[model samples]
Target: MKTNSLLLYSCLLTMAACAGKNNVPATETINALNLKKGKTIFCGPADKQLGAVSFKISGNGKVQEDFNMALAMLHSFEYDEAEKAFADVIRKEPGCAMAYWGVAMSNFHPLWSPPSKEEFDKGVKAVAIAKSIGKKSKKETAYIDAIGAFYDVNAKDHRARCINFEKAMEKLHLDYPDDQDAATFYALALNSAADPADKTHAKQRKAGELLAKLGFDKSFHPGVIHYIIHSYDYPELAERALPAARKYASVAPSSAHAQHMPSHIFVRLGLWDESIYSNTIAADAARCYAENAGIKGHWDEELHSLDYLVYSYLQKADNKRAKQLCDYLNTIREVHPVTPKVLYSFAAIPARYVLENRMWKEAAVLEAHAAGNDWKKFPWENAIIHFTRLLGAVNLNQLDAARTELKTLTALHDELIQKQEAYKANQVQIQVKASEAWILFKEGKHEEALKQMNLAATMEESTPKPPVTPGEVAPARELLGDMLLAMNRPAEALEAYASNLKDRPNRFNALYNAGLAAERSNNAGKAADYYRRLLASSNAPGADRPELTAARLFLEKQKTLAVR
Candidate 1:
């Protein structure tokens, strides 16, 4: 009789929690239901997928339905529906952790959303209660999984957001050990947290070394060195990246990700032998992987493996292998649909091949196919599609298409006005402007190009510099300097770089580019000083280090080729 009475009381509390229409907490900034579907479905476009609801959700009934609906709406980005759904969740379970996570997600996703302090606070509050309740007594079954997902975001703000994501992945990896997303997410998180400052910090160095045991190191990916080199404070410490780079190559000899990274790094470091050696290994390993995997893989796997194999061959100028690979690619793609990466890879080879050949029309078609045609099949490489359209259109002299791409990017930039990245938007603007400037240059309109470059400078200037890991400031500054140098205004370029380098003295690109600017101005003393500094620095990006050596050699021959 007592047990029955206790159960009845518990049921009453649950009933009370779900009783009302106005069940949501008032604190969230965005509507939970609206966010659930990401968009509102008007009466006309309503379909079966829109109406589907989860069978697993059996709760204080309506509230559970509301939560699922809200989660779907929010996931879909239909903020209005999500708002109502979350309100229902709150109504059903006033202290439901997922309701708060819903609010948090609606506010805090990386690309599209922005967080409100109120939503963050509410999420933190709910998560706190969730941790204690879910971990201890299994209070609510439906909310636990959602609670765990939101826990991936850190409370301390001490590590990169990726680090928190990695913690979440650890749980997921434990549950679904074979899922590649877990591995990719974990790799990305580690890649994200590693800053150039890590080069200086003993702890980061040890952590980097320890990561080798897990098959991740600087040579495995450029980001490994990039995070450390760019964020490194002691400009000198950036050299530490090399040891890990070598280690990464040797340890993971067969991994596609591992083979080429060391070579890429070596090329940047002007270590020609090492670069070639690593590139060869990467090329061979990829070839082997594709051949081995071909028999077992379905359409997608075969496509993926083939793409990697062809990419390595193309990079090495093995036209025979490239042709063979392309033939195989065409054969496989015709029979079976490949992933977005495969499409992008296929489009990219010809896009780059004719990049110098000026077959904009062919490239445009390939780019469009790669970017679009998703209705008949799954969408592949959505971002790459947009980027390829811009690149290929511009390459093929389809200014109209490139212009359209730029306009869309601008609109996107405007949409993200307050939420623009640390420096990426500025870089994008710089790229668009540089492209415009280059087209003008190609048309023998140096003055127009210079004007376009100046416009780029203005756009780049308007954006604020973000506090990031060491050496990250180079691209913007380099673009600025390159433009100024192109204008033959070495003094201004020098001043521009000086301003940035003063703040991020560890960034060696500034030093190297600064050397080039000095050389252009017939400032021999300054050029030598820059070259010497470049040679002395280890943190220089792999892409630019050869340019640095070239700059030094050019300086030596300056007297011979007097530009009258």
Candidate 2:
């Protein structure tokens, strides 16, 4: 993992050169030099086969080796490395059309953020170079055409060009049924196009079905397993990809994304232990990569992994791990300034620790602006910190502090909306209303508070969930249940908690509150059932939750009385 800023820039500019609309060198000389039709190539390293794909390229020796290596890296979403490798191929064989395609495709970064204008321009230049190389085989021509669709400068929108590229590949795959790379990439396009808001996830389902038909031996292809998990990222679909999720880490043991990717399914399925394991590996990989590469900032993979790691630890009531993670997050900035992704994790870790542990006092007095935490860079993430602060303030009957935090949340909501982050904006607004509801409840406006909280919960339910964060600060309806219980409305509270469980299953806090509500309502059977479920799922130590003790004693007393 060598850090070469100069090489990175050269890769980008050189890649762009291939996309440029300029004179191309004669292709006759290059084409006459090498002619390789098709061969079955093993992906990944020789000792550890990922799978076999029948690929054809017009190159031999080092050119062929580097090209295949570039493809494997691209399949794993190692864009920077792929770009550099492809650039090296260009140096070896300037006329290799598919090598130019590699460079162009690497610039596209299909699974991550859309490419910048310069990247698109460079990709277009690279495609132009491939075309200028002269007469190409039909197979080479199809590959060039697919990437050309991506770099088609006439197509202004990047996503539209991406769709066009996918459509082109669809035809190529249909034409050449044996090309697994084309089929796998086409599946990736479908998964990328799937709308998160559409709960049906029709596109994702189609992608998964396509991968399944390919007879994707999980051990054989990283993309097959990687895309399967991605296609089924949502909670409803997560269980369907459990086998793929479980196997992905082993398939691409060195990939940071591969290490972290399993947790998407794990978190969705509430498999806390598995999630912890996946994230721990991911974080270690990220840390080592950053150190070895001489990368300064907090690595994106580490931050993403830590967010999931913290959430899983909190769920399991591993207070020791949670505290250590929080401390690590606080000190991470000493190494380098936080990126936007790191900022989210830094804010979220503390918020999760205080709120999840029910340490209202710590949350109430938490420093709003920690050193190296740039609120201006990421107001949306800052909203999470404020949300927990507001929660604590409301719980502690600190109306002034609650009001101030609510005001700050409102400002963040406006900023997010202005930035066109509508989903995050809506999320912030929901938190704002939740805080307002809490404030109203403290002011003795019980009816108003319930009405407000109900409205907030409804809005949150209808809105599409945020993709970046591990989870919401807390579900509004669950908060509503807590408030209802505080007001002695146990029956209503129990209903609220139950409603929350329908959408967000296996959440420990909601189950605990629901049990308390049932107990207060004198429904011993329902109380016992809820408590038993909580205890079964809960990893909280004995001294951590007295409610557990109360539930146990009550059940034991009931058993004794029944015996009598």
Candidate 3:
């Protein structure tokens, strides 16, 4: 019943550790610790390496069935079984590594949708586990290290692998000098361990020093050059990084990791003007690569590049280009099947589209695409996507669906409680939550709507301080705008919406609500202006088609009011 039953088979390590053995049988035994609902079972975190499992599993046990089932599902990748299993795992072991990893590896992954604090905590716990599991012997340590590497592939626990790799590098280089691929592995480990800025600059410096010392670039690893770009005081190094980046990009243009480098470098160097060019090249390269790269790996980089293209165009203030990129992203869902990443991207379209003219119908269609499906495909994003979908339901006056969404909200909150993750809603999720509240407000359930709004605001206020991304502020302001608009306080909503737009004008949530806030305020001229702007925005490319039809209709009705 243990969430993280480490079940270290140390006694059997003698047989399995032999380098002569190619395959290690699943340790012959798994020890079970009886856990029950409401009993606080401490599965020791890696920090707590009581050499025990983890204490953060919380005292509750309802989620045991859920976590176990999810493990089985992941072993099979049976989407439905994986979804159910993951949901239960999170419900049972909210703070355990298994829950986060299970959900991440599930048919429906949390990070794929609207990520929750719960999943992040579980991820953190998983990382802690990797760090804490102190192995006594060489073989035991290697096996533990291997398992840790296995868990770190997911983004949430991704940083953990970096740590483990760095440790491995230290051991191989300093402890056992004869290890194979030590330098390459060491450099790779540093790339993950180095502070982004420090890593980049240091690599360039090291490359230069190595060239000077050895009379050539003896460190021939490609990634060393990739990390050196503009992160530190190495102009020569960064210049070198570009070609290295270009070379890798050329060879594996479809690799999301490869393509992400050069564009990110250019963007970080304050080269906005060149971003569109870079983004396009990388996106196209990635797409081409993905298409031709055989059948095994999924096309993560191509989709990521498409997203970057959308953002790049917006930064250049090129609405047309942004729209084109968004359209491409939209079509990906239709072309690809249902992975968590694909599905969440599918839902994000409506969230952004709402900012355009007003395609209540179009938005509904996108939301419906995810309806009754295994939203569990995206655990991290469940909160965001569900909240956004609920907004579409409210916009179309599907009160029943709106209520159903609230139940989902409750379940998600319960999950968060289990994980005890800090809460501060991302800008987009807040807007969606507020949008749903506005719908509730319109249904004459003013108090209920206020409670919903309050919950969102509370999350914003109470969320733990994490490093804010540059565009992170947009979601909260937009949500406040919707809440104010619903309260018949358009003037306040106008200010909130304006602030949100000014911070991230490309955000669809803010753009869509700008017109609504104006209309309710009876500022006919301002309303028309917002609608026109909405039509021109890039977040939702479909705006020209029918998104603004409703806003246009309203403007026509208000034409005579220009008498003011």
Candidate 4:
């Protein structure tokens, strides 16, 4: 049945091209591309398999295909490519109002950080141009107005503007229930407007329901599947998105974002192999796209993918690949547009490498603001470096150095609060508390250390991780477990490790430490179970990591005892 759908879709595209209509009916396109779990039909450029999308607009038929392509790119968060495609449509037909809308839409990434000042200006200009072209259909006007809400100069607050845009999209979707584009964009807006503090994930769940109702299993619309993944990108809901995560790359293989997006769910589920595969391809695609586009340095997508790649590889104890990636990252002199995404990845990749490997001295000396980029602009990113340095200093027994790092982190945390970045501020606070806890532990204040560590862990548990990172640099709960283990309270340490693992499964260090804690507590069965899990999670053949070796020895001993 899936094969038949692919064949029918190909035939439809061919028939449309041959007939010179340049327009495939939306219903027909959706029905023809209703692919199931199987082989994907590659229908376009090798680097541009944007699954079928038909957003019929009042424009020259000659530019219809280009418009659709741009729309698909927009859905996949390929902003640069989408902007170029929209520009091409405008060049061919100056009166294409919706094309201008597309350019404006490209500048406003709903799920990403708010546009930079330059990008915001560009979007405002595009919206103005679109409105100036007065002869527009009601549908076109609605689309333009919906995007215009985001570019509203009066609405300086990005969140408020996002809410307004969501309201606008809701009306548009209601007015045109049959329009797949309207429904998809509406769902995306809902996801974007979702309150991060709301543990219920009310808006995300609603968005997921809306997308699912659009026939996610059968619909080949990249945005539908992509948004479904975003809508369910939470720990509690991640499993529900596994099917979509498994299928998204196949649907839009050309999109770096599409390839990388699956890792959000994959990381949440601790599916390291799947996450690694997704990020490796995504990083390559991003590099290819950057080179082809004549971009001066790395694209943000490439850096983003590399960050995830480093994380997944480290999880599997593949330090060789992670080190190679770090070398590549070190060689990068610049990024195309240094957005928050790029900044986060820049800070995280190295931090993850040092912290994951537990290279204390190396981490202690790690530089902050090493790149020429202005670290002041992103206090949260700067905090990553300080946090890592603090952790390393504490481990190395450098009390003064740890306090200095902690002081810097505290200042950065204050800056985050001043910027009204509540979510980022909360994250930094967690780091601050953790750093203080470790410093206290080193100062021989075990009770105070545990108290601070538990506070940090509680705060971390209450906050859902943002989609930008795979996981925390060092989870506070895991740190608490480490503190307890160091205090020789193995039973309490084991309990803490178990709790942390429940939230963030399959972390190599966590697994090994949990096993060690259990063994020390004389729960041999639990120790063996955790040891076996650690071995299973790390698939690197013949890996001689001491942790891996220890797990192997412990498990083997348990097996021998069982046989006896």
lDDT: which candidate is best?
Answer: 4
RMSD of each: 15.6, 6.3, 15.7, 10.0
Candidate 3, position 143, lDDT:
28
Model 1 bad stretches (over 4 Å): 1-206, 209-238, 254-256, 260-273, 295-402, 411-479, 493-519, 525-564
How far is 456's C-alpha from truth in model 2 (Å)? Answer: 2.9
Q: Which wins on TM-score, candidate 3 or candidate 4?
A: 4
* TM agreement with the true structure for every prediction: 0.41, 0.85, 0.47, 0.90
After the best TM-score superposition of candidate 4, give how far the Cα of residue 421 lies from its true spot, in angstroms: 2.6
Tens-digit lDDT string for candidate 2 (385-464) = 88888899888888999999999999999999898777678888999889889999999999999999999999887765
| Worst-scoring 10-residue span by lDDT in model 4 | 33-42
lDDT of each: 0.45, 0.74, 0.45, 0.84
Candidate 4 overall lDDT versus native: 0.84
Ranking by lDDT, best first? 4, 2, 1, 3
* 1 versus 2: better lDDT goes to: 2
lDDT of 2: 0.74
lDDT tens readout by residue for model 3, 190-219: 444444324234543543343233211333
Worst 10 residues of 3 by lDDT: 28-37
